[model samples]
Target chain A: MSDMPSCQFESRPRRIVIGSSGVQTDFCSTCSVRPNSICSVIEPGDISRLSEVAVEAIVPPGRGFIEEGAPATDFFNVTSGTVKLFKALPDGRRQITGFAAPGHFLGLAVSDSYAFGAEAVDTVRVCRFSREKMTELLDDFPKLERRLLEEASNELVAAQNQMLLLGRKTARERVASFLLDQMQTGLLPGQDGNGGRLHLPMTRGDIADYLGLTIETVSRTLSWMRAQGMIEVGKGYAITIVSIAKLEVLAAGNG
Target chain B: MSDMPSCQFESRPRRIVIGSSGVQTDFCSTCSVRPNSICSVIEPGDISRLSEVAVEAIVPPGRGFIEEGAPATDFFNVTSGTVKLFKALPDGRRQITGFAAPGHFLGLAVSDSYAFGAEAVDTVRVCRFSREKMTELLDDFPKLERRLLEEASNELVAAQNQMLLLGRKTARERVASFLLDQMQTGLLPGQDGNGGRLHLPMTRGDIADYLGLTIETVSRTLSWMRAQGMIEVGKGYAITIVSIAKLEVLAAGNG
Candidate 1:
């Protein structure tokens, strides 16, 4: 692990070099997830103001960038790859709260310490902004605050849905709901609109933590779905939805 | 239920009049929860802008003010009493997401429909703001947007804590944690500086739903706590914390 903070870049500068005007503009200008991020609220002419404060960092797979209960000093905007956010008990039991895809923002706690920890599911790149700089940006760009409110509202809705899932949904229902949610978010790999193929990024243990179930239960539920012709458990991280209708029924708690 | 929306007043107008300038100013100026609410961001001189848009309504006990999946038309600021927010499954299962106390804000969702339902746990008073009027307020007062962001961040942290509780904590730990949280929030009624007495507004079923436990489990756990001399069950809807230190140990997962 790197000795620097989670938002600091590792000892690799060849992938994306910073500090040059041309490259700085190129980084934010042609970014894939910029339009869906909080940066979209900034006007085209004022894009430099965003690039001026954002320090791009690259995090390796399984590397934790944000530690739960640590001082929250930076805000992160994921540019690429997936990140898992989680909270752990003192006894070492952990609960995976949610996964952050590209365009997700992290470190929005009102308290001085982070409420959860974030780790990269794969090699991830994020634009790190110091709290002071982020506040300055919000001050300069009045629309940014409204944009953040919208972001927070959307997350709140998602959180409520997750609460329902964790509290009331059965093991089978939870897995089915998670699969459908991933498909709706377009997180599936090689999906051709109608294709049911999925390349899940997290492991069964991670799924168990998120769904408040055991890994054995998750595995058993998937096998049961496969037997019912609802899905196909492909090798490794691959899974195919054989029947969306059937999976929807299970996800809705009808099964 | 009144024919009007969830935020509309019943037949009573004698408690607080709205049309007159004197009453309007008095309503916002003397509001007990205003200082701790989102309206605090508005300047004292410009307080009239708020009074102009707000319409106070009284919700009776057990009455639902916000229906899940209904049109998201108004935002609410609880001025008095407790409210239970929840989401229900198709099979009639329900999960109480959280309880809103005085000064808590509701109805912040990006969707056109409310993500959760809210019912008055006691006789509740709330100030209602139409979505359009709220947009106008946000435009006129930029600080309001920041304040709402802060509110959302605080709620997000609470949601994360609830998630950890539901997914990982034992029944004993969950009840202990809930009691401690209530004490820390100072939500107890007639609470002196040293008193641990709590006048719980919600019923045992509400507590069960919130903690993701069945009523039997919640009851059994409370009995166990009482046996351990950690708490005292008084008459209807009353509980006294006999040993805060013991509850702290249980809440921290040491029990």
Candidate 2:
């Protein structure tokens, strides 16, 4: 259940607060994903209180932060990098349920055991909290609970969307939908001064796993899309959407 | 989008409290699904507080309780009967995401609009609450907030499981899994002196929609299972599981 054996970790003590006055350190105040995370729901003066219970940790590329079927102990908020959440069958077949970005919360479990495994797609930084401390924090801060409910509801919506995509969409539609979704999620990180471009941190195999397709099928679809001038594939995983409207049409299964 | 127009309702004063002291009336006190619902999180003496904000309503067979793209305003807890939740494409193609039973909560929209439509599969009883009042209730009781979080987490887990089913399972596997899930959800009811027998409230077309299959495929799969001595079908939708273990093996995709 644990993927830690395949990972190398660098551990360091993260300073939260200097004293018991709930004074936040510069690190907590300057966190890049602060505005997008559940921490945004905290009262201005309560960041230090939250920081006191959070430990900032780093996960190297391909390292797991949470393991499937393991005892659920901690909650994680991704501060940087991408992590794929997956569930594997006993025989080792895998289904990638979701890919979490910075500001996304992971490690939610229905029971005491984690339902999925999560591994960093790249070097990732996360704020980790023990389950007990998180519970106490939720009890102390009603706004945080409300924010959590909203996030959970959003995740449920996304999961339902994924169900529709998996169940109904054709291969071409699936690929188009995935590209559009990646664009919306900021996974594209368009540095070409054009927002239509995408930079995939995850590999083709990851895409295949996430989309329930074979690697060869995924590659074929991308090539076909490129041939049709719908998208341009750069070196490696870089992709630029050449025709957004056409891609949308394809994603809607009308093309 | 409201669906009340299609439903025939017999409205009456749902007396929640007898006096001014928030004493619960027999209606709320004897509600069968209370212990399994959000009301269970309320304090022992707070039933009247909740009941005051809740309106008990019945939805007749084939009537929708919640419609997709509707402005979100109310929350619902099913007290009896089955409700199917689904999303439809612009072209009228539909995919059912889930079915709600007694104690299941519906109408937790991610944004201001409902993402899916919900309809009664049979005569359904539900307790409806205005979103504003529910928010107030959650703020008044932290336990209820905690309980909602748990339910949302559970729903997320179920959604992930359905993702795996939709993305990876074959048609036969899908049918088998659906049957097992119905058994677990008490959809079978099993009041015919046989716990292994199932009474389906939803039609085969509903099953097809929920399983992402054609109605013919669902029927064919069921017939195949019957021929294999894995099940027995009576009049209409009654089904008796002849070998639950074998069915489970099929559900696991090993058959």
Candidate 3:
């Protein structure tokens, strides 16, 4: 399987790379890139201030950026890689609250700390904006402030959708929905416009826990999908999407 | 039968007064009130600013504050009323998204429009903060901004919990959990802290849609609960909770 992307998805904005010395950062000129953060909404003046205060860093697989209840260090935006944001129960169970794809901002808080923790699901590269700098930028750039508000609102909607899924759908339906989402989100590769096949990142166990089902059930469903030829599986957890239309039927329970 | 609350719940907040063409609404400060809406996070100074910019109004029974895609109005805090926030499919099926209790804010947004439609299940009163005033207040008051973030986060968690219910739990368990939540949230009056008993607000039909079950199934379960002496219901929705502990067990799937 190819670890590198076949073609660079242009929608993903390139990181504004500041040299390791972090000195003399380009705090000037009109940057046309639609930033994935509250930075996007602020004017040039606010961007300069944020650029001055913000630090950029890289996070590798299986590492965490934020922990629940900890005073937030910096608000984050993923330039690359996947970040799993989750909340923990004292009893050791973990519910993945969300996954931050590229262009997604990780932490944008109004308080001292965060209720959800952020962990790197894969090798991640990020740019950090301290709360103070971000706040200053927000004040200086009213548009940026509104964007943050918008992001929060959108987050609420996404959360509500997740709630509907967790609170209402059957396990099979959840798995089906998850599979279809992977296809649409470009998380799956190898589809040549026919939506034929793609690779899966987490294991069956992860899928089961995420959907609140046992691994055995997840295995059974995959086997069923394979038998129906709605899917064909290859080595290393790769699945060919033979018929998304049929899978949609299965997901909606008509099947 | 009485709309007036009989018992004053300690540690639980009563609804705030909606409209007072006055200077500041310091309901959160100095008052023995627990915070509900994002406004609860604001200090006295900011709350005063918020009050200056907001208007209070009462909503009659069965009326909605915002419809889907309507131009943004004043963001709201539900001072009094039972609100059912729901999303309806084109096919006319409705999913009860959330129930807004007292002290919780409704219609607060970072966008120009509301994504879901909100209607008062009963006569409702709300503190209305116009879009212009709200943006100004959020910009000026960082503490309030933080609270808004937390509120959004809390809403996010609630959505995730719903996902678990909708995607995994059995029909019986969903209804059971819904009942448990109502009791805990005071949507229905809880057990007298002695013998456990609860009154339900919406009917079995409502419960069926919310839990993704049929009305007949909901009715069957209610009958089952009665047979086990778990509850007793009389005319006019006089539902008596017999065993909170046992109900919790049932909700957890022990039943």
Model 1 reaches an interface RMSD of 0.7
Report the lDDT tens digits of candidate 3 across residue range A132-191: 776676666656655666677787876655554554566666677778877855445445
In terms of lDDT, the best-performing candidate is 1
Rank by lDDT, highest first. 1, 2, 3
Clashes of 3: 24
Error of 1 at B235 (Å): 1.1
State the DockQ, from 0 to 1, for candidate 1: 0.81
Q: Can you give the TM-score per candidate against the true fold?
A: 0.93, 0.90, 0.67
lDDT of 2 by residue, B48-163 (tens): 68878888887888877687878888889999999999887665557889999999998876698898888888888888899999989987998887788889999999988888
lDDT of 1 by residue, A196-232 (tens): 7887888888889999988899999999999998889
When 1 and 2 are scored with lDDT, the better candidate is 1
- For model 2, name the residue pairs that clash: B1-B70
Q: lDDT tens string, model 1, B56-120?
A: 88888887889998899999999999999998888878899999999999999888889999988
* Candidate 3 lDDT, B135-239, residue by residue in tens: 777777766765666677567656656655665566666767887787765534434573445545566655676776678988888788889887776676556
Cα displacement (Å) at residue A181, model 1 = 0.8
lDDT of 2 by residue, A1-255 (tens): 233434334553574545467755646677889899999988777777877888888888887768887889889999998999987655455678999999999876659989888888988888989999998998788888888888999999998888877877778888998988888665444343333778889988788888877788889999999999998999976888888787888887763
Q: Which TM-score value belongs to model 3?
A: 0.67
Q: What is the interface RMSD of each candidate, in Å?
A: 0.7, 1.4, 4.2
DockQ for the candidates, in order = 0.81, 0.60, 0.26
